[model samples]
Target: MKNLDLKKHYIFFIGEELPQPEAHLVQSTNAANAAANLGYSTVLVYLQKGLKAIKPANLARPFQPRETPTELVKYYNLHDKLKVVPLPMPWPIDNFRSKFTDSNTIASKYYLPFHILPTTKLVHSRNWNFVKAAIKNGVPAIYEHHHHEDKPFELEIVNNPLLQIAVTVVDSIRETMIANGMPEDKVIRLHNGFNRLFMQRQPEKAAEWRQKLLSNERSYLVVYAGALQQFKGIDVLIDVAIKMPNVQFVCAGGKPPEVEHYQQLTKEKQVQNITFLGYVLHHELASLLQAADILAHPHCSGKAATFTSPLKLFDYFASGTPIVATEIPSLIEFKDTRAIAAWCEPDNSHKFAECLKQVLETHPRKIEGYSDSIEFVKQFSWENRAAKILSYVEESLRPLLIT
Candidate 1:
């Protein structure tokens, strides 16, 4: 096969601040890495969604601090071809275009492209200007969907000629775009990838980490990580704790005021063995996932949940742990029972309990399944993602320029 090499210019649209040290931010950073590996020059511009202004101590770290520094610009060398740009001011439409066209050798650079309205809660007036300018510049704009609210905005932005890609993890999100009249060919369905440092860690190390979290007392440990929102089905988890006094349940995420109040429900229900570790760094999160016997993703939604692809799903797979999640179409794509995570109804406490019980009862099966999942997930590695993205980049750039 002929290798098509071109120094194609890529502008990664991060609606939020860069170097915020969050998983979503890291995923965007890695996308830049993937771009560079394909022999393209990638520029990641952070729109500064108030994350840069927050002082380090004032903000909570998401995972254990590793190579990603807690500073405003967290940089790593995915490849020599990558460069990250962080804008301290609001998304400056004029400044972005001028820089991209004049300074950067790419097509006239424009503001970081993004959109949201009254329906998509993510939109701010400041960012709307940037989105408009990118459309006007004829830049290849891409919108990433981290939540369900982004669905409508993704549709709206597709109207612009600059709309080249819509990256979403949830399988059902495609319907949302179709409902809003977007062609299927315009979008890309790329799920998130784990950092090599976390994905390739030794199993023995994982076992050791698991031991530290559970100690010798608990026979089984169940972990649920994310914000303690109502849609998260955290109450169902608490109910499980009450039903099964013998099992230890651990909840990891940021402690919201409502969640703090929800702790009262846990106490009232007399679920004492539950441990709450507020948001941890990604590395620390891996250790927590390693420690758990199974991961519980009890997100429940009659409407909003359909369009979301939680980052934790792939993270759980990367950890090589069995998952008991709600039957979201986003998860249906991975249906291998051996490596496949369990699915149950989110609000149905009995169903959730039974799913967990099955995992516990079939202890050997669970172990074998986890082992298989670890192997299966190897194909979904960052290296593989880099390869797939390069394929698209090569195809896109070949006719215009060739090496």
Candidate 2:
């Protein structure tokens, strides 16, 4: 193991085991990679407990050091500059708790503050406990909030003088934090972004995927590329698929169990047009979105639906494909924007199907008022997102340094 410099920026997340197909992991890794590329020495620290228990193949070579940048690059499409550090929970306790509780909670709250925070120059994380710990231990911290959760300690933590910034993905979240007694100036809203290197117009690759997915009968391909949870509107997508038998539908993400369950549901319903291509790699996603005639974001109405920022939305925009999405609060801003091709009420499968059909039929011919999508999505690249956030952090720290 190489000695880590305390001057480097440390981004910590008590995440799931490595290389898992999860959105949060994607966001954190991309931020770290971008920060490193921007010439900041950055290290991404995540928990790797339960790997031996969950993935038996790891037992062949037990508890090796952190995965190399090469391995991470292959798995995450990361650049070579970023450093990844995986921390393991205590041995016997981890084995016992792995069955009953989330190891992330224990490790983040108890282990990380004492072992990792003291060595970090600046800490950035999504975990509330980890961020709180960093501030408590006298390290400058940044908290990135993604969801609308009721945390009792949130107000105290965000208001702490040691905390440099609180970043939210939507304006509503920043508003909520301010209403709950957080300092107005300390919080800012910045949306998620897409990987520009991969998520661009790839005409030749798009044609290849179109050749494979489309047939003589089914000329159009509609895609939904995200988690296959009920709240994510997979059920609504299934209902829409039932209504539109002529349009070929494909889902590009989900865990194995979720994929199996959805597959059975579609089978029971006797729906023949929809297929689940579970857990497509990040780099391959752009070509898949490019291959689509229309992209679907059928999120159902819920607490998560109100404030959630779906990473797939940006990726869909980057592909330059027309988008059909539910008019949830978080996504409503894009309704009038050129990014979305069509919009419908949340969880209304009939309306969703009708909207998708209208877009599919009218596309390849401009959709009247909407501008060019590729040009519209140019500002939402991952590098640009990271640069903006880091600039904010630097500005906030400048006065302290001057004194």
Candidate 3:
């Protein structure tokens, strides 16, 4: 922290551990990697202690001297230029803390902002507490919100003079923030993006995956990739698989426990056509997607459905495969829904199966309007998203720099 020139450095603060299966970790690490690739002197700061304390194996191993750990680089496919700094948690308090007074919260809220304030030109983070702390200390900060829930003391935080911007992943979130008195000019809606690497199609690799995934009986493959949560409509996907006995349905993302639970659920329901591939690497996702005949986005309706932006949706677009998705508010707002996907009603397995059947029967294996989807997704690349956000920040801070 000593020799850093503030003007040359940009800090991205995250409260979670890297190399996790969560979408947030994927989004944050990729954004930082994109910023670094754009030639910003970027540093990604995360906690050494996550929601839980470091494991015994991690304790036994010596600390990594490199700026970015090897595991993280392989896991997230991060750029070498991006620096990673893990802030240590408070000693005894972290070792022993109650749920109400958690150490991760303490470090993120109180320690991280002060630690990076003097070292960085601008702070970008999804953690509201970290952003609030940075803004309170007069450091320029950009806060990105993904969820629909309102933060405590939201108005006070948004109105801070040093708060450079507030970014939301969907229009509903932006509208909600504005309805709560956040300045219209200070808030922007930017969707989560797909990695640029996804655009590079690996035909041989995709063929290999198709060979491995497809069977003699089931000539067509329908794939869904992302968290295997109930809200994400994995249950509905199962029902769809049950209805379509001859088509192979594969899910390509989930933790081990989640995979086990769903596998058990399938067994109980006697659903034979479905398979779950737990936690595929980010780099391999593109090839896996290309192997699919059709990609499914079956998110259910509820509070989460209103504001959630599925990262996989962008990747699916990039895959050049036809998409079968539910007609949720978030998907409807994209304007290109009809252009990129075949829509069905949320939480309705019968309708979803009928929609998939229509797509399968109509297209064979190739996608309709494939060129349009590819062209449309060009603007939603990770590099473009990062550049747009960074440019806005620089433009907003120009007057401050002039003075």
Candidate 2 TM-score versus the reference = 0.85
Tens digit per residue, CA lDDT, model 3, 14-54 = 88656689888889898888888877777787767553345
Report the C-alpha lDDT of model 2 over 247-317, residue by residue, as the tens digit.
Answer: 89999999999999999999999999999999887767777888788889998997888787868888777
Quote each prediction's TM-score: 0.71, 0.85, 0.88
* lDDT accuracy of residue 368 in candidate 1: 26
- In terms of lDDT, the best-performing candidate is 3
**lDDT of candidate 1 over 1-403, digit per residue (tens):** 2222222345554556444435565666766555555554445555333545243542232111122234432232244445554443423332466643232222113223221110111111113334445555444445555454343454456675555545566666655655656667765677776554445545565567556555456668889877777777888788877776677888877545655777777778667877776655565666667667778988776775776556666667777777888876666566655665567866888888888889877643232236666776677666576556445432543212111
Candidate 2: segments with Cα more than 4 A from true spot: 1-6, 50-71, 97-119, 154-156, 179-181, 365-371, 394-403
TM-score of model number 3? 0.88
10 residues in a row with least lDDT, candidate 1: 116-125
What overall lDDT goes with each candidate model?
A: 0.57, 0.74, 0.77
Return the candidate ranking by lDDT, descending. 3, 2, 1
